[model samples]
Target: MLQDNFGRRFYYLRLSITDVCNFRCNYCLPDGYECDHDRDFLSLAEIKRLAAGFASMGTEKIRITGGEPALRKDLPDIIQACKQTNGIKTVAITSNGFKLAEHLPTWVDSGLDALNVSIDSFDPRQFQAITGKDKLDEILSGIDNGLSSGFTNIKINTVLMREYNAHDINSFFNYVKDKPVSLRFIELMQTGDNKDFYQQQHVSGQHIKNQLLANGWLPTIRHKAAGPAEVYAHPDYQGTIGLIMPYAKDFCDTCNRLRVSSLGKLHLCLFADEGLSLKEQLQIDDPLPLQRRIMSLLNDKQATHFLNEGFTGATKHLSMLGG
Candidate 1:
């Protein structure tokens, strides 16, 4: 396993299968954004080889992401290939869940370990306003289908902005309380298309916690030993609720993963401008240098993202970062 300066073990690698998406979510990928790198996107075979390379270097968990991973045609093939890799223990995916109703079961058969579905609001109109799409019913139905298909450890990711969805936090928790899925409330970060929306939407983990307390929640961590999300199980609630505060409180200190863009560039930090490209070397008739380059860049993982640096404007959308 790869260990950083602070001894945080690196094992997870988020692989973006494609940068193309279906929705124009305001905070994620907006409609007017002109930069598209579909031509530079990695082929299925290349992605498989990259996964094998990462697995060879002691990475065990690989989460297949995309602008909307479901938008990719042959996603199951990639999942199967990653799962077959000896060192990789988990193969997962993160999607908006718009197309999940159709392809989720196929993904399970393809060996997906878990899933994180992005659902901003339960209100149909509000969801449309947030996602720039009117598929709230489809998204919810997709979650139900996944659950019915025996996906027990599912998680719903909801970004709680100050005015946008803060009022709906308790509603979201209440709705998912009876389900066998974990609900994650992510604090809005100022990045990508969210840069403009950041000032108006910035809400802290403290704000979410305070709301839970007001709702008569004596919440405690669902697992004494959990990952970055400060997960809590309500006293009489069925499922757990989690808080991800990347902006208010950085978890970069214990960050143990890196992102490989669909175009084969490795980003050490989410906000970093530089990326190590492996596409060229992977195409050539050489493997040793490519592997060395990967490990060398991994060793140089940033201690923390400069979210506090007052970085403004949506320079790179979340899709560009393999969200």
Candidate 2:
């Protein structure tokens, strides 16, 4: 196992296939954002080799992320490659659900084990305002399609902001109360592009928890998961609720994952800007050298990030870092 100095065994990998996205969410990406076509993204073969390497080192879970992973024509191929890797027990995707309906069947056939879709609000106007897209109905239909297509572990991710979609909390819970999907409310993080907005609208996860408690939602003890979300359930509801408060809560003590950008830079922490270039190391004909280098870098992983200290080291956009 890839154990860091702090004894955190790294087994989860959040791999970003591409930085290109279909929507310009107010907090994640800037408006009129254009992906640089000239930048080199990791090819399928490189991604497979790296994934296999990580699996060999005791990594069991891998979540494919992106500005929007479904935008890639070869996404199904990528999913299948990760799923087929030895020692990889789970393969999932975090998507915007823009073109999810069209690609859901292919993804399911490719051995997708779980899914998390980004849906900020139930109201059309608020949804459009949050995501800068007018396809609220399309996203809703995609959710239904995902359910009908047999995705059992589907989750809906909602980022809570004080001035934004925070008021939609009750409506969001009401909409998913009878559904088999879990609704996760994420606390806004201070990213390079959204720092100002985050400062202005950040909402504490404790407030959301209090609201749920007031609404008669009881906390439930659940099995430990790789992700950072604190989960809850109510007997009257068909699905559960989760809270991811990176800012309000210190989940770093339990951090057990690493992230690799689409361009092949390995990030030790989501808020950390410094990363090792695994793509450059992959050029060598021998795989052992690259694997050894990865292990060495893993040992140097920082115990925690400085987000709480208001540290912003790199100017790269959040999409480039991969969520």
Candidate 3:
């Protein structure tokens, strides 16, 4: 197992297949996605090697993320490669759900275990305003299609912001009350280019927690390989609620996940200042050299990120690093 200096053993990997997204979400890309320069993302063979190396080190859950992973026509192949890799127990994807309904079958056939669709607002008008996309209905429809097609339990990701969806928390609760979905309210995080926006729109996940508790939402136990979300359930509701409070006390205390940029660099934390390139070792099929480099990189993994101190590190865009 990959144990950092802080004694946190790693078990999850967030691997980015590409850095291109088609959304302009207010908190993330209000200006929409821009191409700073030409780039070459990882190939299928390279991704296979990377997953193998991590699995050899005891990583079990691999989440495929991107600016929008669906944009890649070969995403199913990517998912299949990771699923077929030894020691990988779960292969999931986080997408904008742009055209997920049209593409769900291929992914399921390739061994997709879970799906997370980003839907910030339940109202179509508000969703378009927040994400600059008029596809809320389509995305939700895609989710329904997946469920009807026998997909695993669905999870909807909503980024909580004072200006965007804070007032609509109850609306979210209503949406999930009748459905068997897990709705996660992620606290707005500060990034390199989003400092001013974060200041303007950040909402506390704790406040949401207070509301949930008052309403009788009971905290549930998290899976061993779960992401950093405090999940809750209620006897009166069919769905569950989760809060991802990054700025909360000891938020990173149970860090067991790591990220790999699309360009094949290892990120100890999403907000770390720089990434150590593993591209060189990725070219070879040997896991020894790759594992050694990863072991060396973990030595630099600190106890937690410096987000509270206003340091966004090398993360200007979560899409780029698959946060």
Candidate 4:
């Protein structure tokens, strides 16, 4: 098992397969930004090798993230490879749900364990304004298709921003009242390409909770999950509501995960500029070296992130860091 100096056991890994996204979310990516086609992403063979190494070192969950993971033509193959890796218990993906509808059946067959879709707003204009795309209908269709495809653990990720989609909390809850999926509201973080926008529009999770409470929603104690979201459910509602408050509340003490970019850099913290490069190490035939490198990096994991201290780090965009 990989245990940091702080005694936190690391079992989860968020692997960014690619940084290429189709939509330009206002906060995540700048408008008119194009992904560099020349960038070298990790090959399927390399990802499989890394997954096996991580699994051998006590990592149980692997969540595939990207600018948009579905954009990768071989995503199903990637998921299947990770799922088949020994010691890896669950394989999942976090996406913008742009192409989920078209790929749901194939992914389900690929041993996908869970799905988290980013849906900022339901209103057409607000959705376009936030994501710089007019595909709200397509995204909604994709989510419905996911539900119909029997994905029980599907989650809707919404970033709460003041004067933006914060007022749509009740609407979001109402929209998914009968669905089995969980709605998770995430507090806007200081990272990403548009830090200025985040600073201007960031909303507190407490404010969202207050809005839900005012609307007769009751909170419930829920079991802790691999992610940071705090879950809550209404007495009469069918779906549960969750809040991920990275800024409003400190979750670093209980953090137990690591991230690896597409280029094979082991990120100890989401907001940290430093990381251990695994690109060259992965090329070696021996797996022991990669395993030791992972252990060494975990030992050096930051006890707490400095996002609260106004340290956004060098890798600011979510596209580069993965969602």
**Top candidate, metric lDDT:** 3
Write out the backbone clash pairs for model 4. 192-316
Error of 2 at 111 (Å): 1.0
Angstrom error at residue 65, model 2: 0.7
List the candidates ranked by TM-score, beginning with the highest: 3, 2, 4, 1
User: Against the unseen true structure, what C-alpha lDDT does each candidate score?
Assistant: 0.77, 0.82, 0.90, 0.83
lDDT of 4 by residue, 1-323 (tens): 88899888778899999888888887788575576546788899899989988888889999999878888899999999999999988898998887667888899899999999888998989999988888889988887887786778888899888877977677887877898888999888887467689889988888777877887877666432378777777777888888888865557888878899887889988887775789877886578999988887776777777778878776667887675
lDDT of 1 at 165: 86
Clash count per candidate: 0, 0, 0, 1
Clash pairs (backbone) in predicted model 1: none
Candidate 1 residue-wise lDDT, 161-208, digit = tens: 777788766688777668878888887777755666888878787877
- Candidate 1 vs 4: which has more lDDT: 4
Candidate 3 on 1-323: residue-level lDDT in tens?
Answer: 89999899999999998889999988788898897856788999999999999999999999999989999999999999999999999999999999888888889999999999999999999999988989998998898888777784689999998977898788999988878889999989999888889999988888889999998889999887899999999987888999999999999999999999888989999999898899999999888999999999999998879789988889997888767
Assess every candidate by TM-score.
0.90, 0.94, 0.98, 0.94
Of the two candidates 1 and 4, the one with more favorable TM-score, higher being better, is 4
How good is model 4 by TM-score? 0.94
Deviation (Å) of 178 in candidate 1: 0.6
Poorly placed runs, candidate 3 (over 4 Å): none
